[model samples]
Target: MPTSSRSSEGGTRRAAAAALLTPGLLALGVSFVVPLVWLARMSLNRTVGPAELQPDVSLSSYVDVLTDGFMWEVAWHTLWLGVLVTVLAVAVSYPIALFLARTRSRLRGLLMALAIAPLLTSSVVRTFGWLILLSDDGIVNSALSTLGIIGEPLTLTNNVTGVVIALVEIMMPYAILAMIAGFGRVSKDLEDAAGSLGAGRLRCFVRITFPLSLPGVLTGALMVFVLTVSAFITPRLMGGGRVFVIATEIYDQATTTLDWPRASALAVLLLLLFGVFLVLYQRLFRMVEGR
Candidate 1:
């Protein structure tokens, strides 16, 4: 073929590739970008209902969200829950992940299956399990009664603590998968080398294994934190309508109160915070990866 003909065919292929990307890019913009933009616009809109003909876009939503003591309290509650869940899940999963990584038995699949089985259960189902167990006349109470650990049942449900317990159960599986991936990627040769150099098990783990697994732990923690932050069913069921987080607040504002502007504003606020966290995580990850 002539040089010009070959060049023309190459350019035609490039054009076709760009054309194929256009639809995907357009869909992404419509589904994600457009909604984000609309939420941002609504955040600035203060219209309450059909009464207002023209909604003025301003900083009122942000001002309202920031000034409200209730929202701040709710935000604090959510963050505390996220942090507690992340810490506890990491603590619990560390050993289990290590066990899974080290074990080579046929039953290892069964053990790993147990961790993943909870994930297969719906969020509602998992929370409901906690609800049944934590109730005054439930299995936990029965076991305690039978064991004489306590004379009476404990009040475990209808509180933030109850909600946290359920959240941890569901979130821990996700954290485990992340840790397993991380630990699996780590070369055991390093650990063996450290051990041969006179390091004890604890030292090898702390100095080599733990440091190398930091990326996994960090990513897993972040994933658990974000999921717990947005999770609504567990909190709604276990909190007994007494506790409110940002997600629950969004639900209440949009559904119960029929406040679109407020809901959108709250959503925008959440997205802003999420963006801040993502940026922070990226920077922190870079530092860790550099090490």
Candidate 2:
């Protein structure tokens, strides 16, 4: 072909690729970018009343959010809750994922089904189920009392502990699935070779299997952390309006107080904090990879 024809063909392909990507880009802008821009704008607006916000721009909302000791406490609670849920979900899912990855038995399918069964249910239903199970006079406390472990029912419901437990159940399936994918990518031959080199089962897993599975673990942890941090229904139900996270605070501001600017400000801050966490996580991953 002539050079001119070759150039024309390349241009055509580029145009085709751009055309294919245009719809997705437009959709993303409409669905995400526009809302984010609006939220940021609203955050800067001044709250004039319970039902009204003035269009005048100011940083008072953000200043209030940042300076208020209570808001800082809520932020800390949200961060720690996210971290705890991620850790618990990853820990509980790792062995299950390993089993699913290595097992060739018919039971593996049943086990996977069981793991994912909670996800098939509605979030409301799941949260209510947890409420039943964790209530002061509920099954957990009753069982403990029956076993003489406690003289009275413990305050498990409407607290951080209950929220963590519920969130863990909701997030565990995702963690397991991610880890299973990672574990599947690892070659069994590598593990066998480690064993042949006089490594015990635990040593082989630690040095060979676990390291190889880090990518999946990290991915799952990130997912769980984000979900936990953004969770509204589970925390609301499990915490019984007593445990206040950012999401709950946003809800109260938007609905109860009718302060759109304050709610928007909180939402923006939440996004910024998550953005910071993502950057730090990426840096940490890169450092681990470098080592």
Candidate 3:
């Protein structure tokens, strides 16, 4: 086709694409934007309980959520949990992922099955399992006591450590999956090429494999962080309701306390905190990926 004809066709295609996207844009606004706007408004409104949702707009909820030291502490606790879980999950799962990546077929399938089973289990059920294993008299303590490893059981339930472990268990599958995908994307030929050129395995990984898999690392870490930050059941159950995360707090405000405004304000704060990650992605990952 001639240059002019090509340009015209491209323009027409763009116009048609825009037209097709309008409905989706509208749906997005309705589904996400509308509730978000409602949430913002609710954040400003005064809420006595679930029943008393008045339109008397104010910042008391924001003030309350912000001024409370407990919320800040809870937020910090959740943040640390997310960071630790992300790091540990990635660190622990990478080797497994690499192993699976290298394995031919059947073993890879088995590893994949093991990695995915935890994810397939319900969160409540998983948390319950942790509770059984981590409680003072549970399997861990019984095993230790039987083995004479220690005189008594250690405290794992209703603690940060327990919560972190549960979160990590639940989130590690995603990390492994991410790493496996990442490793699949990396060409083994590159490692072979490096090896042929006198580069050792460690050197090959450092020089070639690590950098290429970073995108998957970024992706997996982000997914784990976001999920852990907003996680409700595992934290609540494993942490013994002492684990106060944004998601749990939101639940309490809206469901238990019947305080929608405060909940909405807390929700908005969660959104803002979550949005920081988008900023981080733009600044950090885009630079890494040369986007």
Using lDDT as the measure, the top candidate is 2
Weakest 10 consecutive residues of candidate 1 by summed lDDT: 45-54
lDDT of 2 at 123: 82
Q: What would the per-residue lDDT of candidate 1 be over residues 1-291, giving only the tens digit for each residue? A: 699999999999999999999999999999999998887776677755542413777777678778999999999988888899999988888888878877879899999999778878799988989999998899988899899999978888999878988888888889999888867546778989999999999998888888888778888888888898888998999999987999999999778776667778888877777788888888887877776
Minimal lDDT window, size 10, model 2 = 282-291
What do the candidate models score in CA lDDT, each in turn? 0.85, 0.90, 0.85
For model 3, which pairs clash?
A: none
lDDT of 1 at 94: 81
Compute the lDDT of residue 268 as modeled in candidate 2: 98
After superposing candidate 3 on the true structure, give the runs of residues whose Cα lies further than 4 Å from its correct spot. Answer: 1-31, 48-53
Model 2 lDDT tens row, 190-247: 9889999999999988898888778778778887899899999999999989999999
Looking at model 3, which ten-residue stretch has the lowest summed lDDT? 282-291
Question: By how many angstroms RMSD does model 3 differ from the true structure?
Answer: 3.2
Over the full model, what C-alpha lDDT does candidate 1 score relative to the true structure? 0.85
Model 3 error, position 98 (Å): 2.4
lDDT of 3 at 277: 90
